[model samples]
Target: MGIITDIVLPVSLAFIMISIGLTLTLGDFRRVAAQPRDFLIGAVSQIIVLPLVAFALVTAWRVEPVLAVGVMIIAAAPGGVTSNLLTLFARGDVALSVSLTAITSLLSVVTVPLIVVTAHQHFVAGSGGEVAGDLTVTGAVLKIFVIVTVPVLAGLAVRHTMPGFALRFEPLARRISAVLFVLVMVGAIYAERANIGSYFAQAGAITLTLNIAMMAIAFYGAAWLGMRRPQRIAIALECGLQNGTLAIAVAASLFHETLYAIPAAIYSLMMFGTALAFVFLVTRGRPAAV
Candidate 1:
């Protein structure tokens, strides 16, 4: 299990992220500059607001310290490729969705480490002193860069160099990513099976609360800011669905703690159900695409 968590999980996560990159083009980044207001709204909501919300929830719930940090780690993770698919299905702005995913992921190379280190200091060290060989900001930053950023950049390179090939392979890549995600979820659950029920009992409600709150905040906040329906839907899904595979991999590979990965695995399951219901509500009377 250690070998699988430490080795296979990270590698698989990198592949999933690379597959995401393969779907991206330079235009995805350019779209942010093209429409700065919409992009900024989504980016701020994702990179800033969501983590703050997660922290507040964990602190309010008096969650176990390690699990609190784990939840924070999930919050710090960038939006997943699943958001793009959900956006498409929800009749949202798929371009904006992809742009947010790409930008947040790149920014997470910085934000994730900062948030995780802060959570560790506050929850882990502040409460009970330090754990030796604990994850440091520098190590977290480097590992995220290597595992997340590098693969994404490689995928972007592939897209740029072979546009046709990239397009042709994207559907298959997405399918592969889906499969890898399931396997990672299984690995995480299996690794923590002994304590699965207790972990879920501990973090399940908190994670569910976090997920629903984020979606509502994103959707209502975007609407309040007068964003169009499509953009609102995009923001809602992006904020709601995190990159759980990355979160789990980070916990298992970087922290080597099954308890740390439990929140992510549970959150992954919770998000799908919530996201589907959201899709149903938003799409009931709307056109297929806006």
Candidate 2:
């Protein structure tokens, strides 16, 4: 477990972030400024609305304090590399999806810690439990900056200076990152293998509900607001397929609780099924409905 958290988790997450960075360029960031409306909507959905929805869920459901913090951990995560790939598969705005992932990921340096700390305070600390010792927003921000932001900026630098090498290596990097993701998932569940059933049973319902609700809210909200079909698909899927790897790392590293990482582990396992169904539903049906 120590090896997993200390070595496997951080390295795997760093590689994933680097892989995401491989897909990004300066233009992706510029796209945020160029198309401010969609970006704003996507950002607000993930940053503000997603956490709000999660808080509402945890509070209303009266989830246990540790698991409740786990719920908020996943909620605080940004869109993963999978979101961009799934966006492409869903016939959505690939560029917009990539832009959102890149932008939100960078923003998570600040936002992830903010949400995690708040959740810890409200759910864990407020419950009069011994909270994860000394977890502060500022401390989490620094950890995320090192684990996420620095690797990402390094990836961008590599791509910028050595475009040929980056393009050649990106596919392999992505495959490696995917393998790392699976390893992390297996390790997390295996470490808690004894508790897997009880943990999953307790956390699964809430995580699944959170996934479906957010996707529906984002997709329908975008549609109702008259956003383009592709953009709607992109944002909705982005909201659904969060960076659960990052969430797990945050929980384990900061809170040092496998208990707190349970929701993210369960969530990583299930989000794909829901996302695929959504993609199938829209693609098989009429685009006009969107």
Candidate 3:
């Protein structure tokens, strides 16, 4: 577990970020700036609303302090690559999905630390205070930048410099990212096997509730805002499918505590089943592509 946390987790996360980048183009960023409303809604739902809702759930559920922090950390993470894939499967706006994901991934380098620090102060400080010591705002930002931003930028650079190669490699990169994500989740669960059942008992219901509520909010909220069906689907997924791998990596690498990573590991496992159901429900009898 120690070696996996120290070595495998970070490397796996970097690969995932790189895969995200390989799918990106400057146009994805530009598209967000050009048509800001839908993008803003998706980003706000993810970056701001999701964490607030999770915090509310944490308070209402009276979750264990460490597990509460874990939930907050997962909420603070950007939308996962899985969201983009799911959006495509659901015949949603893939372009919007990519734009939301790319923008939020960059923004999370700042937002994650801010949210995590606040959660630490609120939840962990009154406790033993050791977890707070293990995590500092500067260290969190640096880890995010190095593991998330740098790899993404490198992949984007590769795409720009060798367009044909990037095009050919994107599918394989995504496949590798998916495999690495599973391995990371497994490592997180194995590391906490002694308390896995207890952790799940504490976190499973809350995480599932959060995931469902977020998707409902994003989908109906977008509809109320007069967004198209595709945009609604994209927002729903972006809001729901958080980057659990990143959350777990941050928890394990920074806090060195299996307890802190438990919610993310459980959420990651739960999301695949829920997301698949979401895809089927949303895409039933609909066109295959947007």
Tell me the lDDT of model 2 at 124.
80
Ranking by TM-score: 1, 2, 3
The TM-score values for the models, in the order shown, are: 0.97, 0.97, 0.96
Model 2: residues >4 Å from true position, as ranges? 285-290
Instruction: Mark the regions of model 3 whose C-alpha exceeds 4 Å error after superposition.
Output: none
Candidate 1: worst-modelled 10 consecutive residues by lDDT: 129-138
Instruction: Return the clash pairs for model 3, or none.
Output: none
TM-score: the better of candidates 1 and 3: 1
| lDDT string, candidate 2, 48-88, tens digits | 99999999998999989999999999999999888888887
lDDT for each candidate structure: 0.89, 0.90, 0.88
Comparing candidate 1 with candidate 3, which one achieves the higher lDDT? 1
Tens-digit lDDT track of model 1 for 118-195: 898899889995563657889888988988999999998999999899999988888888888898888888877988
Query: What is the C-alpha RMSD, rounded to one decimal, of candidate 1?
Result: 1.2
Off by over 4 Å in 1: 132-134
